[model samples]
Target: MKTMFKKHGPPPTAVEDATFRIRFAELSAGYAGHPVLHQLSAGIAAFTSTALVGPNGSGKSTLLGVLAGVIQPTAGKLHHAGGRPPAFVPQRGAVGDALPLTVRQTVEMGCWGARGLWRRLTRQDRAAVDSALERLGIADLATRQLGELSGGQRQRALIAQGLAQESDLLLLDEPTTGLDPEARERIAMLLTELVADGVTVVHATHDLDAARSADVCLLLREGRLVGQGHPRQVLTPSTFARIWQPA
Candidate 1:
């Protein structure tokens, strides 16, 4: 897979004066005794949606963690086109047992990246929070406690927090997990709107149908990329059976 992607050369460094770009040249990470990925490489252009699809323990979440700078890679280069760091949205379950906080307060926490230790939010910051809430369709729930919202609404709040960061790249781990079909579609549509606004997104999911909505689909297995490119191109019946069907 590395050789195949290399054949096409790297994507452009400067893409349309866009917000940011990501280029991964030979990135690998795993436990101390064993490696999960080997010489993996790819280039993601600005404002494009890339979906990482594979079976369990395929390193999708690990890859996103590395991109978000939460986990350091064991080897290889993961470059951030611009100096601006990417925002990460973990699954809703990851938020368990946190201190009590309001939805607005949680969204305001997103501004922490833009604030100093002693700096407080100004009028502009408050306005940004309100705008983010509105964008995620959670304005009416702003004053509600984060613990009180339903699963879908909570997901929206988390996504809104990421958006409030004003980052060019957004890394999401199973953003639509546990949602009904309607909730899933709504989240997908929200992602499409984000792309239209020039925000690059890299999401990891197990659903092939959801993966197809992305511009690029990467089929990963046992920490290796088996296929890459358009969903229809990479997700053939043979590939599907090989990954999902039992031996």
Candidate 2:
């Protein structure tokens, strides 16, 4: 079957910008003996949303993992200007739901990095959790078991957890996948608000519509950087075909 999306013209070359939150220089990473991401050099703009797009096995998740500090690059260097750990929200399936944790408990976990595992949450910590829940509009569901909520609700809860971390940078992997249109829109809107508030968001996704909403789009194929620039300008038909079409 043909792909669900159409393509446009070739994207213009990426322009170097002075304001960047993170910079990857010749970054390369892999698992075991095999490499998934090749030498990739790119910069994520500060206080903006950047979408990582490509077909499966394109190394989007790998890149995100590197940025989140969960995976070490086999070669090259990744530098973060903020010098603080970023909040990473993996795909919902990655999070085990059998733990019997409530939404509030889950969201509060975001503070563990700052407060330490054994340290008690202070009044300020509690307030941060409250604000995160309220920000995601999940305050009413605070006491609900995470397993009981719908996919959309659960996603919001996870995002609330990320927000509770209060990190300047947020990394998400397919946060809008397998959701209704309304749910996707809600997530997108929330991301926009976060970016406006000086939070940098980078999400790896296959959704073109979601990619278009980002301030910057980074396209990858076979773990190599294919394109990077404004989505409307970079994600053209020719570019999509090059990335998505079978050779």
Error of 2 at 156 (Å): 0.4
* Pairs clashing within candidate 2: 7-237, 8-236, 8-237, 8-238
- State how far residue 34 of model 2 sits from its true place (Å): 1.5
* TM-score leader: 2
Clashes of each: 0, 4
What overall lDDT goes with each candidate model? 0.82, 0.89
TM match of model 1 to true structure: 0.88
- Count clashing residue pairs in model 2: 4
The reply for model 2, stretches above 4 Å from the true place, is: 1-18
Encode model 2's per-residue lDDT on 10-77: one tens digit a residue.
32123433377887777889899999999888889889999999999999999999989888888776
- lDDT for each residue of candidate 1 in 107-156, tens digit (9 for 90 to 100): 88888888954699988888889999999999999889898888898999
lDDT of 2 at 199: 95
